[model samples]
Target: MDAQQWRIDVDREVCAGTGLCVGTAAGRLRLDAGRARPVREVVEPDQAVVDAAETCPMEAITVRSLTTGEVLAPEL
Candidate 1:
């Protein structure tokens, strides 16, 4: 069976140049042009990535389960 994958997204328009996501998951995310972006669109499931998404002050980061299409971060 294939391992699960997660999809990370950051709304550039909503991002406020906060580095929280990058700080939370440095290896999985980075700051580009003062905005946070995922190192890769799709990645292996990672808690740090989820945490980063959850902690985004602008609520700009989003993490989803690729296999299930379930939103994984920024709990509503």
Candidate 2:
């Protein structure tokens, strides 16, 4: 089976330091300098991460497909 690759990116410029992503996706997202940052450039974000992205009020978190360039969601 192909390893489904995923990536989580946080737009620090737009981030409001809400800490929602960190709270939602503690495994993949963290609060840095009051902004959200991805723990890794590429991560197989579990459901929590996806849920976190959805919960971002600023919509700063983005989840995308690494190989296909398909945006999973603007905020998830």
Top model number, TM-score: 1
Those runs of model 2 whose alpha carbons end farther than 4 Å from true positions after fitting are: 1-3
Instruction: Give per-model TM-scores.
Output: 0.91, 0.87
Q: Kindly report which residue stretches of model 1 are placed more than 4 angstroms away from their true locations once superposed.
A: 1-3
Candidate 2 lDDT by residue in tens digits, 2-75:
35888888889999998888877876888888888988868774787778778889888888888876888663
Question: How many steric overlaps does candidate 1 have?
Answer: 0
Per-residue lDDT value at 73 in model 1: 92
Candidate 1 lDDT over 1-76, as tens digits, reads: 2448889989999999879888899889898998888889899888998888888888999898887879989798
Clashes of each: 0, 0
Query: Ten residues in a row with the worst lDDT in model 2?
Result: 67-76
TM-score of 1: 0.91
